[model samples]
Target: NLEYQGAFLYGEITANYDVRNHLFEDIKLRYDDIYKGHTLELGNYKYMDDGAREWDISFKKDKGYIITGSKNYVIKENVPLGSRVELLYLGIIIDIQNATNGVVEFKNDEIKEDRNYQLKIYTPDGKILIKDISTTSNYNQQNKGEVEYDINIREDHESKRNKIDSKVYYGLTDHLTLGMGYLREPELINDEYEYLDKGRLEAVYSNYIYSLPYTFRVGGDKVFNEFEYKVNEKNTKDDYSYDFLGQIDIKKVRLRLEHESKGEFYEDKYKTKFYVRYTPIKALDLEYEREEATKRDGIYGIDYKEKINKYSIEYSKAYKDLLLTGEYEYHTEDKGKYSFNTYYTGLRTATLKLENTWKNDGKDYEVAFSIFSNGNRLFDYNLEARYTEQEKDKFTFRFSTNYNNWFDYEMFVDKKGNQEHKFGIDHITDLRNPTAKIKNMDSSPLKVITFVDKNDNDIYDEGEELIKNVEVQIGEQKINTNENGEAMFYGVPNYVTYDLEPKIKKPNFLLGNNKVQVQGKNTATIVAHIPVKPMLTLTGFINVEDILELNSIDKMRLYEELLVTVKDTNGKVIDRAIPDEQGIFEISGLLPKKYLIEVVYMGIDHQIDGINDEIVKLTYVDVRHVS
Candidate 1:
C-alpha cells in the first residue's frame, strides 16, 4: 500500500510466506509498550515422547552428557576482603566471647505486593524470602503395541512443599552469621516410608577473610534430603533434594565448589552439581548451570523432576542504551511431559523484539522489529515504526506505521536450512497535545518553588543565593521554566517535594536508553527555594500491633497521623487526624517505642511519602505464642 493523503500505509507486510498454507494469514500490530503492565498470561501445551519403554538407568552406554553447573556473570570486586561475604561464609555455630551486636547476620529476600488495594509494598529488608511454593506429581505406565490383558505396570505418586520453616539464625558475632531452613511433611507419609518427605536443616556461616587481596571464604551445606520411595515401592511424599556449594572470590574471578548426594534408591541422578560466573568489568558477564539426579525416585515419571538442566549461558549489560543480550537454555524433564493419560503441561513463550531510533532533521523516528516463535516455528514478525516531531514547547506530531509481515522471508534456504517467516505492525497517535492539564481551581499558579543553597551550606542561612533551574515537585507531578523560581505542578497531589521523580521519562531520553519507568509519590524534594519543613504530627489514637489504617489519612503528614493514635487496647485507632502546614504531628496516642505503634507515619520511621494508603508499618511485627 502507498501513501494516501499523507497517511502512508504504515502497517506494511515486508515478509514473503505462503499464507494459504498457514493457520494465521498476516499478523500486524504496533503497541505503546512491550512490557504491558497489569497482565497475567496463562497458557498450556503438550508433547509425547515414544522412547519411554526404553528407559534404562545405565550411564555406561548412554548419551555423552556433561553434568556440570553454570553461573551468571556478576561484578567480582570482593570488598574489604572480609566485608564481601554471603551468609554461608561466616561458619557453623562459631562465636567468640562478646562482640555479638557487631555483625548483623541474616539472609533476606522479600517481595510483597499487597493486592489488598494493590499495595505493592516491595520492601527489601534482610531475612525474608520465598512467598509460596507448591509441588505435585502423578504417573502410570502401559504396554506399547501389544494386545496384552493381564499385564500390569506400577502406578503411584505424591509430592508436596511443606510449610513450617525454621528461620533459626544464630548470629555468631558482628562479622559472622549462621542460619538454617528445615521443612517436614509428616501427615502424608502414612504407612509408607517411601512417601515420607522432609527437608533437612540447611545451615551456612560467613566469616571475614582477614588479610586478603579480595574476600575469600568457604562454607558447606548438610541436608538429609528425603526420598519419594523408601525401598523403591513408589514413595508417596518422601522425596527431597540436597546439595552443597562452596564459593571463593579474589580479584575478578569467582570459584564454586559443589558436593551433592542423592540416596541410592534414586538412580541416574547426579550426585553433585555446580558452576559460577565472574565479571572482569561491570559491562561483561558470564554464567553456567548444571544438575544431576542419581537414583532419583519419581523424577522421570510422576515424582519430582529427576532429569537434568545443563549448559546455559546468559549475559546482559546492566548499564547500556543499546544493550546486547543473548542466552542459550536447554532442559530435559519427563515428570510433566505429555502422554496418553494427561497430556497438558509446560507453557513456553519466546519472542524476539528489535527496536531502534534515529534522529535527523530535528525529528525522531523509531522502528521496532519482533518475532514470536513456538514449536520450532516462527509464528509472526511484528515490524513496527513510529516518528515524532518535538520542536514545539507544548505539542508534537506523532506519526506511526508498521509493515504486516513485510520483512518476512519464509521457506528461504538461508545457507543452513529451510526457515519459516511471517510479519505485521501497528501504531496510533494524537496530533495535538498539551503540556499542562490544569484542573481543580481555576488557573492557580502551579508554582514549584524549590529553595537551593548555592553556597552548599547545610543550613539555609541568610545571604545564600537560591540555585536556578532546580526542580520542585508534588507527588510525581512537576513543571519547569520560570523567573520566580516556581514551575507549574497542577493536578499534583498536595504533598510536594524539591524533586518530583517522574512517572514518565522524556521521549528524547527514552529514545536513547530504551525507556525507564520511575515509580513513587514523594513529598521530599531538595531545594532552598522553599524553607518550609513539612509539619509532621500524630493526631490520632494509635496503639500497639495496630496495622495503621493509612487509607483514613487526610491531607496530613504521616508523622502527624502517628500522634493522633495513642494508647488504646490493641487494635484501636485515633479520631480524625490531620497535619499542619509544617510536616509535624501531635502524638496524642500513647505507647513507648517498645510497643510498636502501627505508625502510618514515615521518616521518623521510613521515608515513604505517598497517598496510595500503602501502610508503612513498623519494621517488625510482635508475634504471640500459645501453649
Candidate 2:
C-alpha cells in the first residue's frame, strides 16, 4: 500500500493505492478556506468529522460545499440558473430548492432557530459548495441560543447497503442542551432481511454544581424493526438510559466518578466507575480506576444477573534518558484474572533502544528490542539492528529477528518456536536533490576585499596590487580572500554591523584600517586598505691604504672595528652597519627620505648624504698616518 498527501495553492490533496487489493483505493480533495465559513470536498470523503459512520462509497466525482452556521443568518449566493441546493440539519435532509434567475436565497424562518444548519449547493458545472451557518456567529452573552449537529453515512459495497446517522443538539438554557438522533441500517431480523430504524431523544446538563464540575445525559431509544413478512407482530422496541459524570480537583490530585445505565439494546447493564490521578511532581504520574457492572442475562429463558468488577493502576516516571512505566489490572467475574505489565526505554517511543547518529559524518547506528505479552504469557519479542552510512553514496543494513512464544514455560519446549529472521541491505548512489530549494528573501550578500595602498591614500588605485590568501574575520566567520582579493558571505542578515579585521602582519607594512565596521545591506562591498611602508637599502665599499702589508686576518679585522650609522632628516639614528673583509657595508630599513650616513674609523668621521635611492654606493677612504 502506498499513500501520499500534498497541498496545492488553495487546498490539500490525498491519495492512496493498495497494490494487493484495489489498485486505486481513493483520492480526496478538500479546501477549507474557500470562501466565508465554507468547505469544499470531493472524491471519497467522510460525512462526519470524527470518522464514525457516514462515508461516500466509490468515487464521488462531483464536488460539494459544506456550510455551518445558525438560523439567524441568511444565505445568498449567485450561481447558474436551476442549480440544486440542499439544507441539512444534523444529518437529515431538511429542505431542497433550486436556483432561479441565477440567484438563490434561504430565509431565516425556513431555518429553525437555535439549530446548526448546513447548506450544500450543487452547481451545473459539477461543483459543490457547503456552508456552515451556526458556528460563525458570536454568542457572548449566553450559550442558550447555540446549536450543534453531527451527521455520518456509511456504505457497504459487497452487501450494497447504506447506513445514515444524524444527531441535532440545541442549547435550551445556559447549562442544559436537548438533542435528538436517528439511525437507519439494514439488519437480519428473525430469518428475514429488513431495515431497522432507531430514534433517540436526549438531554444533557453540564455545569458547576456547588463548586463541583458535573455532567449528566439522559436519553431514550426506540427501535422500529418493521418486517414485510411479519406485519402482524409487534416490531417496535423502546429503551431508556442515562449517564452521569462528576469530577473534583484538590491540589495536585483529581478524582472522577461516572455512572452509566445501558438500556436493553446494550444488554441491560449498569456500570459505576471511579478514577483517581495524582501528580506530586512533574516527572511522575500515578493513576487508579475501578469499575463495577451488573448485567441481566437469560439462559434458556432463566433470567439471572451477573456482576463484574475491574480494577487497574498505572504508574509512569521519567528521569533523564530513561523512562519507566508499569500497569496492573484485576478483573472479577466468573473467574478472577489479573495481569501485570512493565516497560522501560531510553527513547520515548522505543521499548529498549540505543542509537548513535552523526549527521555530519553521515553515519547512524541503532539497536532496539521490543516485547509484547498478555500478563500471563509472552506473545512475541523482536530484536533489530540497523546501520546507515551516507557520504558520496548511501548504504543501509538491517537485521531483525522476531520470536513468538519466547517464554511459555511449557512442559515440552518447542525448539522450533515461531520465529522470523530478516536481513537486508540497500545501497543508493544518489541521495541529493531530495527536496526543493528555498531562497531566503530577508538576507543579503557581503563582499570584503583587501588591497595594497601604494599612494598612502585609503582608496585602492588602479595599478595597485591586490593581496591574496589573506584571512578576513567578519563577525564570527573567518574567510580567506580569493585570487580576486575578495571574501564573500552570502545570506547575511540585513541591517547588522560586522567587524572586519585583517589577519596579516608585515614588518614594514601598516594597515590603513585595522578594524572596519561594515553594515550588511543589499549586495554590499567593502575594501580593506593596507599601505606598504617605504624601505630602502644602502650599500657601499671601503678603500684602505697599504692593504698588502696586512694578512687576510688583519684585513678582515680592518673594517670589523669600523662602524657606520644612518640618521633621518630629523637627526634620529635609524640603523647601523659594519663592513666585512671585502669592505662592503649595507644599511637597510630606511624610509623614502633624505638620510645622513656617517662612518667612524680610527677616530675619523666620513659622512655621505644618501637620498631616496634604493641602492646607494659609496667609497670610504682611510687617510690616517702609519701607526
Please report the candidate that would top lDDT against the real structure. 2
In candidate 1, where is summed lDDT lowest over 10 consecutive residues? 111-120
Candidate 1 off by > 4 Å: 1-170, 182-199, 208-242, 264-270, 276-282, 286-293, 296-320, 326-627
Candidate 1: C-alpha lDDT = 0.29
User: Highest TM-score: which candidate?
Assistant: 2
Q: Which regions of candidate 2 fall more than 4 Å away from where they truly are?
A: 1-10, 19-22, 31-149, 168-174, 190-192, 224-234, 239-303, 333-368, 371-627
Measured against the true structure, the TM-scores of the candidates, in listed sequence, are 0.27, 0.38
Q: Please list the C-alpha lDDT of all candidates, in the order they appear.
A: 0.29, 0.50
lDDT of 1 by residue, 220-258 (tens): 333344434344464433234455655555556555556
Question: What's the distance in Å from true for residue 172, model 1?
Answer: 3.3
